[model samples]
Structure formats: C-alpha cells, structure tokens
Target: MITASLESARTVLSEVFGYDSFRGEQEAVVEHVVAGGDAVVLMPTGGGKSLCYQIPSIVRPGTGVVVSPLIALMADQVAALENLGVRAAYLNSTLTLDRVHEVERQFLDGELDVLYMAPERLVLPRTLDLLGRGSIALFAIDEAHCVSQWGHDFRSDYLGLHVLADRFPGVPRIALTATATRATHAELTERLSLQDARHFVASFDRPNIEYRIVPKDGPRAQLIDFITTEHPGHCGIVYCLSRRGVDQLAEALNARGIAALPYHAGLPQEVRAGNQARFLREDGLVMVATIAFGMGIDKPDVRFVAHVDLPRSVEGYYQETGRAGRDGLPSTAWMAYGLGDVVSQRRLIESGEGDEAFKRRSMSHLDAMLALCETVDCRRVQLLSYFGEDSGPCGNCDTCKNPPATWDATVEVQKLLSALIRLDRERDQRFGSGQVIDVLRGKAGDRSRASRHEELSVWGVGADLSEAQWRTVIRQALARSLVVSHGDYGVLVPGPAGGPVLRGEERVFLREDPAAKKAGRSRRGGPQGRAAAPIELEPADAALFEQLRSWRAEQAKEQGVPAYVVFNDATLYGVVEAKPASIGELGGISGVGQKKLDRYGEAVLGIVSGAGTSDAEAPDREPG
Candidate 1:
C-alpha cells in the first residue's frame, strides 16, 4: 500500500507536510533513515527537523514513533499533523486512560501513521510492549543532546532511551539536536549509542535573527527603549538570570503597558503551563522568563529574544536565541552585557557545587560566551565556528553595522598583566580585579594598604586609563584568556596564555569601551543581508496579502493553533503574487500541496478573484 522511493518521499512532503522540497540535509537524512539506517541530525532549529522522519513514515510501511521532551505541545503537534490529513496522535499523560486506549487501538488497527510521546512514557515496559505489537518504521529521538551529561539540559529520563536501540535492533533510530558543542556531539553519539549513524551537521546560522550586545548602561531603561522602538506590537521573549529578575522585569514592563507575563520554575506547574499556552495563543505578548522556560516551546512568531542578563554558555545562548524568528521573519537577538555579568558568572562557577572538572568546563563555556559578546568580528561567524562550522562575517549583526572601535591595547594590556605579576610577586597573593584596579589607580584602599601593593612598580601605571576603561580592559583580558577569574573569592590570576602579552611578544587589540565614545552608540540595529530573502508581492497584491493573512488568523484561532501552523508567511506571499485562480495553479504554489489544494484551493481562489472587495467578509476556509 505504501511506496518507498525518493519520488514517494517528495510526494508525501508536498501533500502531507505542505513543503515543496527538502531543505539542506532533510532529503539525505530521510533517505538514509527510510532505508533502515541510523543518523544524528545536527540541523538548526526550524531547519525542518520534523520532516526528516515524518516523510519516511509516510513512504515506508509502518508508523514512526517520536520521542520528544515537550509534553505540553505534543498534543498540539498531533493536532497540526491531523489537520494535514495524516492519521497522527500522541500518547502522553494528557490523555485519559480510555482516551489513551483509543489511541492505542488506533495504532493496533493500523489507523495511525505516527505516534508521539515523552521519553519517559515511551521507555515504560507497557509502552514498549505496545510498540512491539506493531511494526515500527523508525524511532526518532528529538532533542537527543539531552542524553549528554556534558550538556546543560541533561535529563535523567533520557538516560533510559538507549534501551530502545537494544529492544529494536533493526529499526532505524535518528537522534536530533539543534545545539551541540563538539564535546556534546561526541557525548550524544556515545550516550545514545549511535556511533555508526551518518552525521548530518547543518550550518548553525540563524540569518534572519540579528545579533546585538549592548553595554548595560541603565539596562532597564535601555531595554525599554529597544522594545518600544524596534519591537512594539510584536511578540518577543526577555530572558533573565534569576526568578526574581523575571518577576520584577515582567511587572515593570506591564507597568509600562507592555503586556508581559513572568514564567519560571518557581511558579506552579499549572501557572507555567497556562502562561506558556497564553503566549502561544496571544499576539504581541512579551514573555519575561528565566532560562528554566523555553526548552521545548515551538512557537514560531517570536520576533526577538532579549537577554537582560548573559546566559550560561554560548550553546545556551544559541539555543535560546534560535527560538526567535522561527517563521523566518526579520527578528532580533539582543542582549545587555556588563562587567557585573562577568563577575557574577565567575562567582557562580567558582561557588557552584559541581566537581572541579565540570566547573572548569562550565567556565570554559562562559568564556566562549564572553568571547562572542566581546568579539569585534561578526557574531554569526564566531557563533558557528564554536560548533565546528566555518562562516564569513554576517553583515546582520551589530558589529558589522557599527563595527566596534578597536584600540591598540598591547601596552595597556601589558600594564594590566604586569599588575597581576606584581600582585603575585610583591603581595605574595592574587587579588580580584577590584583590588587590582584600586592599586593600579594609585588608591590606598584598605586591601591595597593591607597588602602593601603601593610599593609595586606596576602600581599607578594604568592611571592613563579611567576606572571604567580599565574594567573594560580587564573584561576583554579575561575574554582573550589573558587573565583568569577563579578561586574562592573570584580572584584574578594570569594564565599561561597571557605570557606572550606580558612579554610584549603578541600585539593585543580590544574593542574600545563604548563609554568613551559618545556620538556613536554601539547598540543600534542596522541593515542586514538575508540568506534567502523571500520574493515580495507587488503593491497591487497588498490587499490580497492582508485578506489572506486575516483568513489565516481566523482559521488558526478556530483551530486553536498558531497561524504559521496553517500556512507560513512565504507561502502566502506566493499566493498573493502568483494569484492562483484554480487548484492546478494553487498546486504550483510552494506551500500548496495536493491535500492543501483540495481543502483550501477554492478558498484561496475566492480571495484572489474577489479583488477590490471589502476584506472584512471572511472566507469559509483559509488560504495559508
């Protein structure tokens, strides 16, 4: 009854998923898995990861079982799949016992094509027994990086997933993740037992999302300016480091009429669920939350992801920032970074309960993030390079537009490094950046006097720079591995990497402190280049685009799903521009599959033909 070929895969992609062709590695991943081969797919978020296996299940002879961590939205995804005329259902805790039995019956009777469940549920003996009763096309492990203890998002339940491999030897298992450092990638492969699987590592670049990092000068006010100016009347996310910051920032934004809601682990589970659902359904609502939120959320229209505080690692930042602009719209990834963030992150790492090696790894991660934030090169290049991918400078980031002012900090850095050496030799101890700065500024502070640091030759040598300038130098030093922030009291010690800079063998260049530059601010948005810019509809088709969008919104609300789930913005642009007046022409459109054309072709043509009419009159079926 089913055909297994590339042609069949293409047909299923167009008809069932409403996609015209396979993106980057989707086709290869699908073909490999459809032929009963394992894979570890390293595509970016919104790189169409779901379709890699979804189509194989359609082309192959059995149902595909997906293990996902997002318990709340698995039902919504099933709803979306069923909307496309696929026999899909989820077996999670949300279903009643009888309801679960109904789905199970559907599977047993071969009525269901795909079944999604959380990892814990799928690992249960009863669930395994149920799967054993039926022929499984493949086993897809979503968010597979969670199996790595080296990852920040490690889950204990995911530790049980390796059993799936042993239980189903011949079944193809595809492990997928959006974020993985080299180490995490190896850990994912080993922990999930997918060593021989073909690795499909996609380019980890979110080009539609502009990257920005601003000095935290009155961060709250600066954040207000950014949102009110750039992202008014748009849904976005603001991430804070602590639960208290989440609550306070949410309240502050609400007071300013921003319509924000707070979400964190501190809240009750029901409240968190409610907040998440409301964020999904509502328009233009800003969700202020801690990193505890947004692990598995699939909302597609988040216009920006702003950080009031720095995230723990570059991986976390990449994962978090990828949440925005999922619809491929022009969204932003903005953050406010200050020296205090550096100190706080250092303190947390030093005072953390993890073992020494874990703490060192975490500190290394934090240093990578700091390097990203402080880099004068393209943020996109540095970010992708961290994941073992190479890319040129992306003109979309703040660095490309306002290109940071670089100072020849060789002599100044030599002075700073000399001060550290002085502290080690003269004081017979290491001091934190604060005491070092005080000594360098010729200030007789209590600590400086207690340690007799004034007698050192490096004392007062950095007086040519202001206190803030010196702090920036120190921050940049830490970023460049010229200094280390470790020990119990967050002391500054020079690492071996600083030897060349201290000996003047290597020239050091640092982005100048923006505080010194008054006219040109570093935190402004600029024009960017898109990787694949969508073709815009002509002016004559403007009304039609809005009409089509309105119909889409009403239909999405009717179905209790996001608008993008119905039809993406690019597809709508095609419909308006091409002005398809029949099912054949509709099928010619990119997002219009055979199933979609059958269901919504008449509705789309009605919008195209009813030109110059009041768009207030809604169509019965929407054109997505």
Candidate 2:
C-alpha cells in the first residue's frame, strides 16, 4: 500500500505539477501525509514547500483543508493552482455572499481538490460544521510560526488552530513555515497539537542568495547605487522601517526613473490592492513596504530584497529576505544599517506596553540581530547558527568575498566613554550620537560650542580621526553594549558592559569598515551581483527565451494571473536550453506537467520551431 501510494504521489507530481522528481524531503512528506500521518515541515521559502501538501491533496481521497493567515495571498495561491488545472477555491472576506455560496457548494459536493481558508474563518462553528459534512483528505496549516508569541508576525487567530487535531479525529495534519528558531518550532508543535507528527526540517542555507550588509552612508543614495549597478531593470523589494519612509523612498526611486510603488497598512484598501496587483502582474517594478507586506507572496522572480534599516530580529530578517530568489535563481539580500536604527529599535521595545518578560524577549531578539550586523565572521554562518543550523562560510556573501579587518578599539572606546561620563558629571547633561561623535572628533559645531564641549580634556583628543570613523566606533560600541542609547532623545550613556572598558579591565575589538569601492566590478570580470543563468544560452537561444517570455506575459494578462502561474522563468529557461521540437520532447522538461503540456505544448513547439535567429531582444539580466 505504501509503495502504491508513493507511486501515486510521483504520478501526481509529474502529471499535475509538471515536475519530474521531488526535491529534498518533498517525497517523504507527501508519502507520510498520503498514508494518513501528520507532518510538521520547516522548509525555507522558494524551497518547493507547497508541493509537500499539494501533491498529497491530489493523490489522496477528498479535499485538502488549508488553514492560512494571509487573506490577500489566498486568491493568488488558488489562481496558481487553478492554472495548473487543479480544483482549488478559497473562502475569504473578499468574496461576495453569492460567490461564497457557490464555493461552499463546490466543497460540499466534493468538487474541490483543495480549499484554502483563513484561520479565523476555519475556526468558526459554521465553517467547522461544514467541514464535518465533507470528506477531508488532510489539514495543512501554513505560516505556523505565527503561533509563537515571541516571534515576529504573531497572529492571535493561529492560537485557536489546535482544535483541528481534536475535531478531525483521524485526519492527517501538516504545519509548515519558512522561518523558525528552536523555540518557535517547539511552540508550533505544542500550539498545533502536532507533538506526535513527523518533523521534516530542511537546511536553512540559501546559497544562491548573496548576502551584503553595508554600514549606512547616505543610505538612500547607497540603495540607489546598489539597485542601478547590481540589479537594474530587475524585479525587487525594498523594505523600510516606517510608512513615511516607504512613501518617501518610493517617490525618490520613481523620481530617479525606477518603477517603484509603496505598500503599507496605512494605504487605502484599493490603493494597496492596486499596487500589489501591479507588482505581481508587471515585470521589473520595485515594491517599497514595511513589515506589513509580503507574508505568503508566490511571485517566483523577485531578484533582490533590500532593507534600508535594521530589522528587529534575525527571524524577521530571514523571513523577509527569503521572499527573494524564489525561482532558485541567484538573488541578493542587501541591508544598510546605522546606529540610529539600533537606538530606535531599542527605544521602541523599551517604550512598549508589554510586560517584563515580553520586554526581555524583545531585547534578546535585538541583541542577536545586532551581533549578526557587527560580526567579522561569515554572515551566513552566524545566520544559520541562529536557527540551530550549522554551516561553513558561504563564498557567495559579501563577508566571504571581501573579509573586513578588525582592530583593538579598547582605548578608543575608553576615550569615548570618558567624554560621556565627564559631560554628565561636569555639565549634568547627556546627548545623542551626533553630539557625542562631535565631542570625539572635536568638531566645534554650534551645539558643541554652546555646550562648551571643546573645553573638556578629551576635546581634540580624537581629532586625528574623521567623523565617519568615530561614528563607526560608536556603532561598534553600541553593538557590544559598551554604550547604550537611552530615553526619547536617544542620549548615549554607559551600558552594563562599559564599566570594565572604562577601567581598562577588558580589551575591545571592532570591525574596520573597508574603503568604498566602485560598483559593478566583481572578483571575476563579469558584471557585479548578476545572477548566473543555469545554462549559458547561445545568442539564438537567448532570443528564443525572450519570445517565450513575451508569450507568457500575454497569457498572464489575459488570464489575470501572475506570469509564473502560466510558467515560471526556470521553466522557460529549460524549454529554451532543450530546444524541444515536439510535444513529447517538451513534456520531458522539469516543469512541463501533463496538464501544461496538453494546454500549451503545441504553442511552445511552434515557438521553438519558428525561433530561427530572429531579432528578438535578449531577456532582462538576472539579479543577485
């Protein structure tokens, strides 16, 4: 029976989804669920996570109930599935009463292969009663990390999902998430009542993503340069810390001739929906948003995700960056962090209404994030270690490509601390980073002159160093907790770890920022940060790829779905490389499932046979 079920899974994978073989633990997950066992899956984004349950939903009897938190993405998910010829529908607030009745009718008649519902809707008595009247194949809980109150993006609705196990006696359950620490994983198991389910945790490493974090130096300008030089004319996302920041940055990028749009909860519903739709349907448009955007987006060609400010937690950072490179192509996870980000994040946590334990948890998360930014070691190593995964240096990240230098900044820190202490003791005053840096660099600005900072003994002491260098010192000091920014003004003060450094009892080492280098130059002579294509296509093949993309775009427009729903970029690349001349030959490619072959195979074969070195333009370059 197990062997036959596994064979059925393989058949579903090839015929419906158009993939030849399962990747990683996909086959194991499908087989377990198909055999009526539960599963808890921790696979990274773009790691083909949906297939684990999607394949089982097809091979198993009855409809699969998918409880999801992303109301906005349910339509897109169902649309993608429907394009593959699967019987999928979703129940959400966006549907009219008549449409809702039709969907419920489909579910009761066993017409839907898979059904998606928000957690709130799924937990209601009406919805539960409806499910009881139908034959359920399985229960798949997505974004299971939302159950962890300590984690970022917590949703109260997810806490009620434990009822699934109790209500649906023998129905198998699967909980999946792309980002989770050991703590979050434990909480997910406990909260979802999946203690006895099999656990499948994939590696957290995304080798195709080249991680690059830079100290904030004219951050907006820096971002512009990074986008233009590394990922021009590519689809990407830029995350900001505030709604105001999102709006301003989007305007700036548009002024600079980049097609950028803003998305946040603050926007009107229609505006946000419009911007999101355009981002999905159009190519090469940038979405500048806050943490409110991008939870379960299925767009497969996002080439880069840039952050102009420090994220509050490593888990949040990982989840956001995972949205890029979903096509398994080379992509970039780029961030620009500064001392202000540190102070602001700390202030927000301290000033929150949460109780003591909650405050402490938030602080711990921040400390880990700070360590990731300031580490002189490989960033990938530190990141994976946070998730309890071990890995060696990834040569693709910025640190591995160009390692930074470290030096003993103990004396420098002592000097900076002494100045802060003298000001509080002598003048009974405290100031923020700008004032303190001025005191260190001995810049006699108006505020410094008014405060008589130059009259102190430490005045002109750090004159030998530049303002930028001193700011770097302050940033490293804050990271190490040798100094802390406190109160609304974010005044610098001695931290718990500062006492030893003040007395010369302990030495401090800090990473020295490298000199700025020209953009668009790589270790090799190729263009910097460009994603390497899977196959180096000949000029004729490249033109053929472009033709295929044009055709796919037109299809997507007519169908009102994301282009990847018709066929992802990886599939197109495969088609061009293979130069399949017949329907049978095209069906042999990885993404060419039986449904797609039956639908578009003749059109594809025509493109291939007719694509004999016409002057079609080359496809846009891939970004890293």
Candidate 3:
C-alpha cells in the first residue's frame, strides 16, 4: 500500500513530473483526490490537468486505471510517463497477445503506476474481472465531456463508464475535460454519476491563442497566405468540412511545396495511422483533416489551427482551436467565414433526422457560432461568456488589437427585406441569397430574370452596394435572426426578429467589410497575440539552445519517439534561460524531474558548459 497525502503529491509532482507547483485549481484537486475524495476538473487544454490525477495516482496505493477515449492518446501518454521513469502501461487493441499478458501481469503484480485502456476495453467483462483482482488507487476518466450526448465529441462507449462509480465504490474517481458548456457539464456529472464529487472549474481561456475570424474571400488562397507569411515551416492543422476538401486542400498545399497530409475516416485505417504518425514524428507538416481528427492530441508545439469552413458549434470551435500552442507559446486560431457557410450549416441542421428538441439544440449551437463569427466585441470574451465565465477584453485577439468598423446598415437591410417581401407577396416565391442579391443589385441572373424580379420595386435599390458587401449584410441578418434560412435550398425568409427591424423599431448596424488582413509580428513583447514572439535567448544562449535541440532530436530519433517526448520546447527554454553549469543546477530547473535529471543531466550540463559533443549536423530548429 502507498501513502496518500498532499505532501506526497507535491513530492511526486516535483520528482516525477518536474513541476515546481500546481497551476490554478490543480493543487486543490490533487489534495482532494489524494485524500481519497472524488473530483470533476474542467480546465483548458494546456492547463496541466493531467497532473491533478497523475500526482494522486503516484501518492496513493496501487495503480491508476485511466480510461481514455483514443488508442493513440493512451499510447502517447504512456510513452511520455515512461520517459519520466514512471511505470506506466496500456492495454489496447494494438498490443500483441504476449504484450497484453505482460502488461496485465505488471498490473496484477502492483508494479504499474498507471494503467490505461480505451473505454471499450474497460467495459468488457474480462477487463473488469482483471481490474477486480488487482489493487486500484483511483479511476480517472479523461476527456469526460464525451459522456455528454450533445457534446462535440460524444462517444457511446462513455455511457458504460457510470459503472465505475458503483463497481469501484471507494476508489476515488476523478473526471476531467478541456471544454464543456453548462448543459454538457451537468450531463457529464449526471451521466457519470458524479453528483457527490467536488467540481473544480478553471477558467476556459487559452490566452496563448489569438482568435481571428475573417470574411471568406478566396479562402484557399487566404489559407495559403496565412501559412506561408505568418507561420512558415510551422506545424499546424487545417480543418475542412469534407473528405474531398481535405484531399484537395492537402494536394494544393503540397503543390505549393508545403508538406501537408490529409486525414478523415474515409481513408484506409493504415493510411490514416501512417499519416498521423508522420505528422507526429516529422517537423513542420500540416494536417488537412475533417472533424474526425484531433480529440486527444498530445503535441505541444502546434503553432496554428485554421478552419476553411465554419464549425457546427462554438464548443467545437473552442475545442479544436485549443489544440494549438499547448506548450503555452504564441499561436493563432483562424477561420474563414461567409454567408454560404451559414446557409450550409442551417441546411444540415434542418435536413437531419433528429427530433424537434435535437434540431432546436443544434440550431441554438449554430446561432451561437454565427454570433461569434459576426461579433464586433472581443472574440475571446464572447467565447468565454458562452461557457458562463465573465472577463474583459483580452487584448490578444484580432478585435482587441485592430477593431473593425461598423456602419449603419439599416437602409441596406430594409432593401433586402423589401425584396424578400415583394417576392413572397407578389410572386408567391422565396429564393436563396444569391438570387435575391442578384435581384437587388440589378444584375438579375437567368433564374431571377425568369421570375420577373426585375419588375419589383426593390430590384435595383441596392445597386450601389457590391455583392460582397451585400453578403455581409445577409450574414449579419442571419446572425441576428432577422432572417431565417428555410427548406432544402436554404431560401431566406423574414424571421420573427425581423418584424421589429422592418417596422423600424430596431436599428441595424453591420460591420463594414474588413480589408484582407494577415497577422504580422506584434510590437508587444510577450507570448500573446497572433504573431507574438516565442521564447527568446541571448545570442550565445540562442546558439546553445540550438545545440541542445539538435541533441534532443538525435535522442528522439534513436528512441523512435516524437522529439517532444524527450524535452518539450518549454523545458528547453528553461534550460537555455537558466544555463546551468552543473548536473545539480540542471536538475533544479523546471521539467528536469529526477528520472530526466539522472538520464540527461550530465549531457545537458555539457551543452551548457560547451563541453558536450552535440550532433551539429542534426536538425537544430524545434518542431512547431
């Protein structure tokens, strides 16, 4: 049996994980779990949530049975812990029979600190029997939001997890997730039967990520420019709405001499795995994928995440964007938004097989997403507000840095509404935005001309405005629910809210079309903003940093692991900034836990003292 106390937790945190202290609610959560209490921790992606449970597992008796959602995540996490000299093992489908038996024997012999398995495997009767025969310190359910049926990354396998509460009675259970709305939070609590558990909700803010949503104008070109100019040769993820889009975008990026890969469910399993492996192991390769990717990624140096299409909900957007800059360096969350994206999302919600309540929930999610895209306020503030947190402007997002201008669009909106009214009243027809805009702009296409919309009084009223400007009008209207998309063709009809606007009871102000802007280096000197500077070192220390990175790369290559598994950029930053001359001094630095200190302390000292034989020809640049 192991001793459990906050003191032991702190010791494990320093000796095993190499952290000097707990961040945010981590200390309280760790103390609670170590004292044999239950907890529900809601922290951001890079908020050091894993330590809350990881420390307690080491402090308490027996192995920690961690139920993760992905095999990739389980493998990656186990590898990382093993590198820290923790006796961690995992049982997943990828393991051979003999390897599985060895892990099981390790677990039964109480030699494992943490044992991980997918939820599917954990729910099996054989697996449960094996767990029943061993000593268990605690049960950790990572990615706890998956239990929420309406959450962005729901999994049916999570429903069976509630059994842990009843089966493992006194084994202190802790549930954790990076993103969740109040409804999802409540659902996670109830579904997982954690009503009595203490809830520790941290701020859902990723200050390191700069949020920017722009009007879609040649979005593919915009993406290319964003990558090449602002984040050239940096690892990133580009999200597309369809597999074909993923394939085409990956090919287009590759054609432009960017190393890019495509990932979606349609690809063969081996192909997807190979692509994912390469993306993890290689440096500066972008992954163009659909929503099927990036649930439990452990990569810490992703520089940016770009979306060519609108996500289904704000929660989904936040979750996906949170994948960037997990190491707390500067990064960007960018999206290309337009009227077509709104219509496409609306059509999907209306044409689905869900019940009325489900459709209503989905539409609510979409409306919130639209509001985020169209908001003139700080995007980070609005995003956090959705999750029931209050904060002032972050001064890091696009709106905070370069606020957009808005114009009195009342006349333009009245003209668009009048055209819709005329078509409905006189012609008994409704049309999509393209046809309606064509009628208003006095450039009636064949479809609009066939309907004789040219005879309408509102036909040529909007001729002064360009089509792109009119699109802004329509998108803002839809965002405000002044107009609603209906039927399979996404035809626009006056919404209930539009009654007040049409009656002149409410004034309309729309954001002016912003000029195409690409993020540039921020004048502010901190890890904040889109082009914020990463860790900076003096000239001599910078050279030392490069040499240290080269040695790390060689070590990772020899071990067949991602370079970060040896030492993340943040750790190396600590090493470079400290410039320790002795092994004891090196071990005192953050992230230089006892295991790593014993393993690489001397070599790090050598690098710092200019005595180490670094593989100079090795890659010197850190993988983004």
Candidate 4:
C-alpha cells in the first residue's frame, strides 16, 4: 500500500512537477489510486490526465506500470519526467535488449518509480512473468479506448490487458483515454474489466480551437494559401488519404518553398521515425502524412491541423483535429472536403473486411460525419452534441461566428433530387454522381453516351444550373436525407423522406451553399471594420503580464510541454485581473491550485505587488 503523507505528496508535486496543486479532480484521483481503487479517466486532450496516475505512482508503494501505445509518447513522457529529476523509464521496441533488461532489473529492485511499455510488449509471456515478481503499484492503460472495437485505433493486443489485473489482483488500475464517446466509454470499462472503477470526466469542449471547413476546389493552391497566410513559420500536420497523395503533396509543398516532409507506412520504419522526429524538433516543418502518423504525438505548439481529404468518421476527425490548439492559444482546424471524398470513403467501407453489422455501423458514422461537414449551423455545437455534450453556439467556428447570406434553394433542391430519381429509373440505378450531374445539365459526356441516359425526361430540366451548383444541390440533398448512397451499386437512391417529396406531396426547404471564397476571407462580408483597440493597461501591470507569460513559456520549454499546460490563458487573465499580492491570494485565484501556488506563488505575487510602486503604496489584496 502507498505510505506517503498528503503533505509529502504536495511537496513532491510542487517541487518536481512545478505546480502548487492539482487541477479539477486530480487530487481526488491521486488519493483514490494511491489508496488502491480502480479508476477510469475520460479527460480531454489538454486536461492533465497524466497527473492523476503520475502523482500516485510516485507516492504509492511500488513501481508504476504504464501501458502506452506510441513510442513517441513514451519517449516524450520519459524526457519530460527526467527533466523534473524524476526516476522514469520506458521499455519499447526501440530499446536495445540490454537497456530493457537493465530497466527490468531496476523495476525488480524498486529503483524506478514509473515505467512505460507498449501493450503488445507488456502482454508477452516473458514480460508478464517478470512483472509477476515485482510489487506492482498501479497499472495505467493510456489511450485505453484502443480496447474498444468501435474505436478508430482498435488493437487486438489491447484485449489482452485485462490479464494484468487478473495476474495482479490487488494492484490499483487506472485507464485513461483522450477521446471517447459514451458508447466507447462503456465498451472501455467492460473490456478493461474496470466495472467498479471511479469515472472522472473532464469537460470535452475546446474553446480555443477555431474550426473551419472549405469546400474542396483548387485544394492544393488553397492549402498553400492557408498555410502561408495564417500559420507561417509554425509547426503543423497535413493529413492525406493515400500514401501517393502524401508524397505528391509533400513534394508540391516543398517545391513551393515550404519545409514539408512525407510520412506513411510505405516509408522504412527508421525513415518514418526520423521524419516524425524532425517534425517534432524543428519549427515550421509541415509533415504530410497518412492517418497512420500523429496518433500519440505530444507536440504542443502545433498551430494548425489541416486535412486535404475527408477522414473516415467524426470521431477520427475530432481526434485528429484536437491535436491543434493544445497550447490554449489561438489555433485553427481546417479541412477541405468534397462529394468525391464521400464517394471514395463509402467505396472503401463497402469493399473492406468486416461483418455486415460492422459495415453498416461504419457507414452510419460516415453519414453522420458528412452531415456535420455540410451543416450550416455552428460546427462546434453540432460536434459537441455528437459526443453527448451541450455547447452554446460557439462564436469561434466558421458558421456561427461568420454566417454568410443564404438564399432559398428549395427549387434547385427539388430539381436535383428529381433528376436523381429519373436517372435511377432510367439507368437501373447504376450510374454515379458524375453521370447524374451530366444528365441533369443536359451535357452528354462519353459515359452518358455509352449508357444512353440522356434520353431521360429530366436530362435538360436542370440546364440553367452550372455543374458546381448542381453538385452543391446533390450534396445538400444527401445531407438533408432526401437521397442516400446505395452501397452495392454505388448509386444514389431516394431515401424514405425523398419518396414523398418526389410525388409532389411535400415541399423541401434548402439553403444556397455559400459562394466559394479565398482561404481565410471572412464569409460574413468583410471584417466588421477592425474594432478599436482597448486602452493600454498601466505599463507596470502590462509589463508584469508579459514577464509572467515569458516565464511560463520558458518553464514549459524547459519541461518540453505546451505552455498552456503549465498555465492557461484564463489563469493569466485572472492574475492580471486580480493582481494577487500574496500566496493566499494567489491560491484563491481560479486555476491556482495548491501545487501551483507553492511552486510559483512567491514569484508571481512579487511581480504583482512590485509593479510601479514601492512598499509604501501596497494595497491589501483580496481573496480571489
């Protein structure tokens, strides 16, 4: 059992981790785990989930066994911990046999406080036998959602983790995941055998991330425009769907003088690792990679995450996009999607390996994601709602914050849906969107001639609309549930709601798609003439805030973490607003927990009280 006193724990936490107190339920989680209770933590990406287990591991009686999936993450965590003068090590494929044996000896000798390993390696019979001899303190399963079949990163080896608890029945266990829906959470608990575990869920909302989705047109140029304008000299990831696409895009960006690198499974393992390391170590390096990379990357200053192609599901998109803005400073999540993305993804699902039920579920997820991409409402509200969270219209995303003028497209929608139905009946529902679009515009392409579909009644009915406009109409039709993609034939079929509308018994309301604009141009007309800048704060207060920010950044850099993870903007704003003059006053400010106060309180309060005045004019500071 753990033997450390609360005072000792607090002292170590402040001295080692550079924080005065834990955030949110971190203190409670540490106490519970240290007392040998099982825990399941569902915290957001930047919510300090690691502290819950890390603190207990230090204070608890035996060495902590942390199961992590990514080698990069293990290295980063070990590096950060060692920077704090903590005894931590990770065993993975990257380690030499001698190093692994040495670490095992250290674990047996109770010299190492925390050790990280991949689940695949940890579940080995030899490894399990070795662990059986040690006094296991706690078993932490990081990225625990990988145990769920429904998760995007599901791994078969994760199913073997439950045997650890069976082997060490008395040891405390903590499972943590950065992203999990309600269903995923349920699956995680059951699969990990954490039936009696306490659940700690931090808020999933990311307020600092500004979300944006532009229709895919001239995508390469647009991507170049966006990266150059908004995120110049910043680290970022650009995701592509195919390895070939990754190489081509990386080369293209390089040709355009961007420091871009390509990463995918096709590359040699060492090459991939080198590119990934370069991306992490170098600023302004854009890594164009397939979905395989960046899963557990801990790079905090990533200014943006852009997707040139559509992700498979909303969960995948959300998790990928969440990598940005982790520093709590301004960051962007941008994606360029088109109808072709929907077609290609559906094709992949239909042709992939899975049972019928699984395929259908995958398709449903894709459909929901498509709806989200095309939604005209606040993107954040819709996204949060999918995760079973409620959020007000976030005035930070593209739609809610910058609504474009929309015109009624009911007539255009009716025309497009009608054209789809007429073509289906004429061609026996075998033609794809391209042929359907051609028939609708009365333009007879080679495929249309081969299929002889131009003789249909609706062939010339949509002649007034251009091809782009017609594509928008059909996309909206799918989004509105007036049409669905038939998996077997790869054709558009009228949905249940579309049947009545086709019979003229119901009217459909559709809004015009926003006109394509240059990347980063405000859709709500031009910028509301720049707002007047606020009057300057007293120079002393302004100078103090600047010094505080610089100090925070330096600390974060020294520890190799995102700056906000040390102290968020909200906390800094509190310091500026409240001007706490003492340790007690600093502790009372929001986010200034016990660990933080003890670590930096004296310095911060000194800066606050010393600003522009001698001790003569010092005012009594109030409680937060």
The alpha-carbon deviation from the true structure for residue 570 of candidate 3, after best TM-score superposition, in angstroms, is 0.9
Each prediction's TM-score against the native? 0.88, 0.95, 0.94, 0.83
C-alpha RMSD of each candidate structure in angstroms: 4.4, 4.3, 4.2, 6.3
Candidate 3: worst 10 consecutive residues by lDDT?
524-533
lDDT of 3 at 338: 91
Which pairs of residues collide in model 3?
A: none
Give the whole-model CA lDDT for all candidates, comma-separated.
0.82, 0.87, 0.87, 0.77
Error of 3 at 107 (Å): 0.9
Model 4 C-alpha lDDT per residue in residues 74-109, reported as the tens digit of each score: 776786566555688999988899998999999999
- Model 4 scores worst on lDDT over the 10 consecutive residues at 525-534
Residue pairs with colliding backbones in model 1 are: none
- lDDT, candidate 3, at 607: 77
Model 2 clashing residue pairs (backbone): 18-593, 332-624
Candidate 1: where are CA atoms >4 Å away? 1-4, 417-461, 486-500, 503-505, 515-547, 598-624
Better of 1 and 3 by TM-score: 3
lDDT tens digits, residues 170-242, model 1? 9999999999988999999998899999999998888898999988777778777777667765678999999
Q: Residue 474, candidate 4: how far off, in angstroms?
A: 1.2
Question: Mind giving the per-residue lDDT tens digits that candidate 3 earns over 264-374?
Answer: 999999999989888777667899999999988888888899999999999899999999999998899999999989999999999998899999999999999998988
Candidate 2 runs further than 4 Å off: 518-538, 611-624
Worst 10 residues of 1 by lDDT: 525-534
lDDT of 2 by residue, 400-426 (tens): 998999999888999999989988998
